[model samples]
Target chain A: MFRYLVRRFLQMIMVFFATTFIVYALMYWTGGDPIQALAGEKPVNDVLRAQLTKEYGLDQPFLVRYWNYITDLLHGDLGNTLVGRPIKDVLADAWPITIQLAVIAIVVTILFGVTAGVIAGIRRGSIFDNTTLVLTLIVIGIPSVVLAPLAQYLFTIQWKIFPTTAGGDASLWDLLLPGIVLGSLSVATAMRLTRASVSENLRADFVRTARSKGMPGRRVIGIHVLRNSLIPIVTFLGVELGSLMAGAIVTEGVFNIPGVGYQLSKALTTEDTPLIIGIVSVLVVIFLVANLIVDLLYAVLDPRIRYE
Target chain B: MTDIHVSSPPTVGGGRHLLEVKDLFVEFHTRDGVARVINGVSYHLDPGETLAVLGESGSGKSVTAQAIMGILDMPPAKIPSGQILYKGENLLAMPEEKRRQVRGKEISMIFQDALSALNPVFPVGWQISETLRTRAGMSKKDALNRAVELMDLVKIPAARARIRDYPHQFSGGMRQRVMIAMALAMDPKVLIADEPTTALDVTVQAQIMDLLGDLRRDLNMGLILITHDLGVVADVADRIAVMYAGRIVEHADVRNVYKHPAHPYTEGLLDSIPRLDSKGTELATIKGLPPNLMRPPTGCAFHPRCKYAKAVCTTETPLSLDLGHGRTSACHFAKEMLDGTLR
Candidate 1:
């Protein structure tokens, strides 16, 4: 297990470097001059451009510039945005909101989704199963972009139940609407995956054996069926965690919540290369860690699964 | 063969049978229609007696056992009318809670495929101990200790060391032993082993059968061995009940049935076994497929596959005829077959 962890950590480092390099290369090769974007209304001149290029290491070769970025990144320096604000400061201000939204959304998605799925799977073909299936389908079919605004309109503009947009002093109640909108698709996906898994486990011979062992129906479903079905659902949730961070971009926009995703969109408009790279690197690290945790959980959920 | 008869003495406990099935009928509601899977299946099991319910696939041997165990899915499977009497109490008439108490405590089952039968995610010991914990209300520590003891009972070597191993880690034979251990954990009065050795090797098959026979004798439990292999049950089974298309065609002492099969299906099954003495000869096989239960033939389900099937066999369903000494055959020409008057 230690060897497995070491290997995974090494793989994570490799992925981190690869992703950062790709983001850097894409930003550079895309032909948008960060210095010019920063200059705004200022007239272009050789001295100013040269000073800006030298300061950011854009004057150096791609490898050298990337090496400098990596070295600075190791020392906890995320450089600066085109607007001359420190990327680290920007992230420090935005990350907590995104984390809060993602955590709440993920928790709600898993809790409600798995409960509904287990019920539907145990009583397969029943009215409850049919209803959940149809509801999840409808939720999954509507993209978050459409669903988010619709939810914002319903909960805020029309119902007046929630504020139109969250403020700096936003509480859990303020985060609920945006979190639900962001988690809607994931809830549907988790429900369907869990339903399919639980239904399949229900048909497994072990379940029949459990029943024949005189296990009560509730224990049989809970301990045997649900435990077995959780493997796939956990895996899905891990991947969904990464997608949820990405999905928060549109969700944040609709709710006007100041999160990492909101900052990412703002950076994209201004071509803030450093801010974009900082946010992307953080998201990549989060995604990789989630995947690693999921890998560890596999061994816990199933004894037959072992890592050497 | 003489030892086979001698090993199974007449029910030593007098008329107090462990289990008795009376006119048990099971049907499945499928898209086609209601499939009559088990039609009037009846048998009685005595303590320390091994009754092998032998038949081809789809002959309702497993289904009948499932029905008795109360494990069949009710929506698809329905017991229209029947009595599964355990200790003289009709299980069918009892509430689900009462039936559940009898299931693992008084009567337990070992399924065919042990790999699938045992939960893949859990240790074999945990699976065994789960029954002890839930049904017997044993503490976790006590149940685990009992699990190791049961493992030793099934002859799994190094029980303490291997108790933590998952089902997939055990070989087919070892896994089947694990399943047997699990069933025996509750010390049930009746153990229904459904093709327990079917997934095992030839040598392992003999070993499992030997283990089951010894365990049954030691525990004095009524063992219902369900199998399609005629040769496997011949030595271990005290009595053999041969079924064809959901109906028992012959029920007699194992030795008697082997010596003179009163039903053609039973004869065909015996003949199909490749004998070492008859090397280089083509193995005899039954001609046709087992009839579909959805629309079984009007008269006898086996008539189409029986070589000696007469016009009466095709038009009239034969009731079980008593031959002396509790031997019964559901064939019109059972006397003729027994007397060697019919080919």
Candidate 2:
């Protein structure tokens, strides 16, 4: 198991480098002149451009520039934005809000999605099953872009139940609307996956054996059916966590929340290459770590799946 | 056949059957319509006896066992009317809670596919101990200890070492043994083994049958062995019930049924067995498929498949005729068939 962990850690390092390199390359290829962006509408003289390029080390070759970025990253320097603000400070300010939103969104997704799925699966062919199926399909069909604003309008603008926008001082209650909106698609996906997996497990021979063993219906469904069904759900939730980070980008914009996604969006508009790389690199690391954790969770959920 | 050693008859406690099924009828509500899977099937089992239910696929043998175990799914499978009597109490009339208490404690079942029947995620020991923990209220430690003991009882070698292995880690034969160990953990009075050895090779089949026979004798439990293998029935079964299309066509002592089959279906089954003495001969096969339960024939469900089916067989359903010496055959010409005069 220790060997497995060590191996995963090595792989995570490789993925981290590969991800940062690709993002850095994409930004370099697509971005406008950082010096021009810094100068705004004021025309830049040749000496000023050269000086700006030299200061940022953008005058160096791509490989040299990347090597410098890696060395700086090793020393905990995340470079600076076009405005000369440290990318680290920007991320530090933004990360807490995104993490809060993502965590709450994930919790809601799992609680509501898994419960609805299990109930629907066990009571298959009943009205509850049919209704849940229809509702999930409807939720899945609507993209989050449309759903987010609609939810914002209903709960915040119209109902006046929640704040119109989540700011730094907003309470958990203020974040609830945006969190649900951010997790809406994931909830639908999780519910569908869970329902299908649970229904399939209900037909498993082991479930019949459990029933024959004098286990009560409730215990049988809980211990035998639900436990077995959780493997796929866990895997889905891991992938969903990664997407949730990406999803928060639009949701934060929609709700006017000053999270990492909101900062990343603004950075993208301004072609803030350093800030873009920082955010994407962080998201990539988070995604990889979530996947690694999911893999580890498999061992906990299923005894047959041993790491060694 | 000469190597076959029949165990001594079970000590029957004068008219007190351990388990009895009376006119049990099971139906399935499918898209086609209501399909009567088990049609008025009845049998009695006594402690320490092995009753082998022999039949082709879809003859309601497994369904009968499932119905008796109260494990049949309700919506698709509906027991219209029946009585599963255990210790003279109607199990069908008992509340579901009470019935559950009887399951895995007083009555247990071993399914055909052990790999699928055992939970893939849990260790074999955990699966075995789960019953002990839940039904008997044994502490985790005690239940695990009992699980090892039960595994040893089923003759799984190195029981202590292999107890932590999952179902997939074991071979087909070993998994069946694990399943048997789980069933026997509760010390049930009646154990229903549905095609217990069907998934095993011939050699392993014999070994499993021997293990079951030895366990039955040792525990004095009423064993209902569900299989279509006549060879297996000959080796261990005390009595055999031959079913055709959801109805028992013959029920008699194993020896008697082999010597002179009163039902045509039984005759066909016996003749179909390939023997060492009859090499290079075309194996006799019972012709035609088992009738679909959705729309069974009007009179006798087996008439289309029975070689000796007569004109009366087409229009009249034959009731079970009692032959002397605790034998019964559901055939109009059972007497002539028994007398060897039907031909």
Candidate 3:
């Protein structure tokens, strides 16, 4: 198991470098000059442009700048943004908010989505199962872009249950509405995945064996069926965790919650190369770590799977 | 063959048997149609007797065991009419909660493919001790100790150390031992082993059969051994019920059925067994597939596959006729079969 972990850690390092480099290269090639965008209505002379370019290390070749960024990252220095705010400070503020949102969303997903899935699977083809099927389908059909704003309007403007925008400090209460919107699509996916897995495992011979033991129906479904069904759901949730923390651009925008998505969008408009690369590099690390944990969890859930 | 007359099995209120399935009919309401699985199948088991329900795949042997165990899914698998009487009480008419109480306590079942039957994720010992803990209300430690004792009872070597191991860790034969151990944990009065040795190696098959026979004698538990292997049944089973197309075509003492099969299907089953005396000869095989349950043929379900099929056999269903000496054969030419006159 230790050997497997070492190998996986090495692989994660490689994937992180490759993904961050791709994001860096794509932004560099596509983005307009940061200095020109910063200048806005004012025209900058050649000497001032040169000074600005040198200050931001833009005069260097792509490889040299990339190498410089990597060395800075290794030394725990995430360079300043085009607006001159430290990227580390921006990240430090945004990451906690996003983590809060993601955690709450995951709880919501488990409470409603997983519970509904288990019930639907046990009582397959029942009215509750049919209702869950239709509801999850509708939730999945509407893209988050439309769903987020609609949720915000319903909860905040119409229902007066929540504020229109997140308050300063982004407390658990402030982020609750955005968290549900961010997790709505995932709830649908988790429900469907869990339903399929549970119903399939119900027919498994071991389940028959359990029933033959005269185990009460509740214990049979709760302990035997649910344990096996959790394998796929855990995998989905791990991957979803990484995406949820970084991919809440629409929900964050709809509720004006200060998170990675909001910072990323602001960086894109200003062509803040360092901030974009910094945020993306953090996201890459998160995705790799989540995948590693999922692999480890697989061995725990199924005894047949050994790490080594 | 003995000429003495033996009476039919006692139905409910007549007398007590360990377990009796009488005129049981099971049908599955599938999308295509209602596929009749068990068609008026009846048999009985007494203390220390191993009654083998012999048939090929799709013969409803496993389904019958499932129905008796009270594990069949209700809507898809409906027992239209039947009385599964346990000690003069009809299990078919019993409440589900009451039946559940009797299932693992009074009657328990083990299944084919032990690797699949045993829960993969749990330790083998935990699975064995489940009924002890939940039903008997024993503590975890005591239950686990009992699990080790049960494992040793089934002859699994090093049962103490291996109790913590998972099902996949054990070999095929050892896994089967674990399944037997689990079934015997509650000390049920009647134990049903459904094709227990079908997934095992030939050499291992004999060992499992022997274990089951010995356990039956030791516990004096009624054992229902379901298998298609005639070779596996000969030594262990006291009586045999030959099923074809969801119906029992013949039933008699094991030796009588082997020595002189009254039903054509039973004859075909016996003939198909490979023997050293028949070296270099092409093996005998029963003709035609088992009938599709959704649309079974008229008359005897086995008529299309029977070598002695006659004109009457095509249109008239053969009733299960009582042959003397506790034997019954559902064949149009049952008398000729017993007299050795049917060619």
Candidate 4:
């Protein structure tokens, strides 16, 4: 197990360097001069511009700038933004909000998705199965963008229940609808994945063995079916969990939430390289961390997957 | 559902015949539509008899076992007619909850593939203990202790220490042993083992068969051993039921069936096995696949494959011919077969 962890951590380091280079290349080609954005439309004076240029190393070679960035990154330092704020502080402030939303969305989806899937699989051809299939397909087939506004209109404007936008003092209910809307895809994914897994497992020899033991349908579905089925569902959840955090930026924009994604859009418009890089870095970290957690979960779920 | 071995687990009272399956039928609603599978199957288990259901794949041997156990999938496969009576109680007519209680407590089944039959995620010991804890109401500690004891019953080596190992950790023979141990955890009155040793090596198969024989004698539990291998059934089964196209082609005492195979299908199967005493140029083989159930032949299902098939065999299904010497054959020309006139 320790060997597995160490090997995974080492692989993660390799993934980080490869990812950093790719993100760096994309950002560099986007053609933005960070100095100009920080210094406004015009230089203050020729002397002031030169001094600022030298201080920020803007006039240095591109390779030199990338090298310096990597050097700073190694020392646990993310560079300052065009607005003169430390990249780390700005990123840290927004990171938790995004994390909280993503985690909650995933948790809610996992609980409901897996439960609905197991029920649907066990009682297939029943009304419950029909309803779950219809609902999941509806959520999956239609775009979330369409659902987002329609939900905001129906749930917020007409019913006057949920808040239309994310607010400072927003309660859990306030975030519930948008979280469902943003996570609607992930929810569908989890549900469908869980459904397929459980249904397949129900036909497994062990399931027959369970039934032969005279275990009730419910216990067979719950203990024998769902537990084994969740392995694949958890794996899908892990991959989706990362993409949702990144994708939640659009959701943040749509819902007007002050999360990393919200800041990222604002940062992109203002050409703030430091803040954009910072947000991407945090996202990358979360992606890496979530993957690691899922790998560990696989080991726990099936000891056969244990590295040792 | 013959319960000839039902001595009632030593001290338990005589619970009727222990199990009786009468006129059981299962039809599958597949993509091609409803196809009749088992047809008017009837059998009973007394107490300690090992009744072997012998047939090739798709012969409805496994289906009958599944139905008797009430484990048949309902949508795709439905039990339209039958009475599976355990202790004179109709398992089919009884409430599902009542039948469920009878399941792990009274009857248990060991399936075909041992590797696939045991859950991969759990330790073998835990799986055995699961039934023990759930049905027998034993605590985890007590259940686990008994699990080791049960493993030892199956002659699994170093069972106490190896109980912590997963399914993949064991060999095919060992995994089958674990499955047997799990089935015996609740001390079920009737154990239905479907192709138990079909997946094991020859020596391992012998070992498993011996272990089952020993365990059956010890527990006095009725055993329903399902297999197509005639060789394996010779020593273990007290009685044997030969199935073809979902019907029992022949049913009799094991020794009688082996000594004098009444039905053409049984004779064909027996003739197919190579003899150690006399070496034939080529071992015999029964021709053709078993009839398709969707549109089975009008007469005997085996007639199309029977070498001695007659006009009578094609036009009418022969009523079971009672040999009167504790044997039965479903064949039109059983007299000819008896007289050694028909090949």
Judged by whole-model lDDT over C-alpha atoms, candidate 1 comes out at 0.88
Write candidate 4's Cα lDDT for B14-98 as tens digits.
4457677888889999999778999888877877889999999999999999888888878788888878877766788867777
The whole-model lDDT of each prediction reads 0.88, 0.88, 0.89, 0.83
Stretches of candidate 4 exceeding 4 Å from the true structure: A40-48, A167-174, B1-16, B277-280
How does model 4 score by TM-score? 0.93
Query: Chain B of model 4: TM-score?
Result: 0.93
**DockQ-based CAPRI category assigned to the predicted complex of candidate 1:** high
Clash number by candidate, in order: 0, 0, 0, 18
Q: On a 0 to 100 scale, what is the lDDT of residue A105 in model 3? A: 92
A168-253 per-residue lDDT for model 4 (tens digits)? 54557767777877777777778777878888998898988888787877888778887899899888888778877774766677
TM-score of chain B of each: 0.95, 0.95, 0.95, 0.93
Cα lDDT tens digits for candidate 2, B318-337: 99999988899999999999
Q: Candidate 1's residue-wise lDDT over B1-343, tens digit each?
A: 0010112233445674668898999999988799999999999998999999999899999999999899999989999998877767678887888788777778899988999999998888899999888778899999999999999999999999998899999999999999999998888889999999888899999999999999999999999999999999989999999998889999999999889999888899999999999999899999989998888997888889889988998899999999998899999999999999996
On TM-score, the stronger of 1 and 4 is: 1
True contacts preserved, each candidate? Answer: 0.85, 0.81, 0.83, 0.87
| Predicted model with the maximum TM-score | 3
Model 3 misplacement above 4 A: B1-15
Best by lDDT: 3
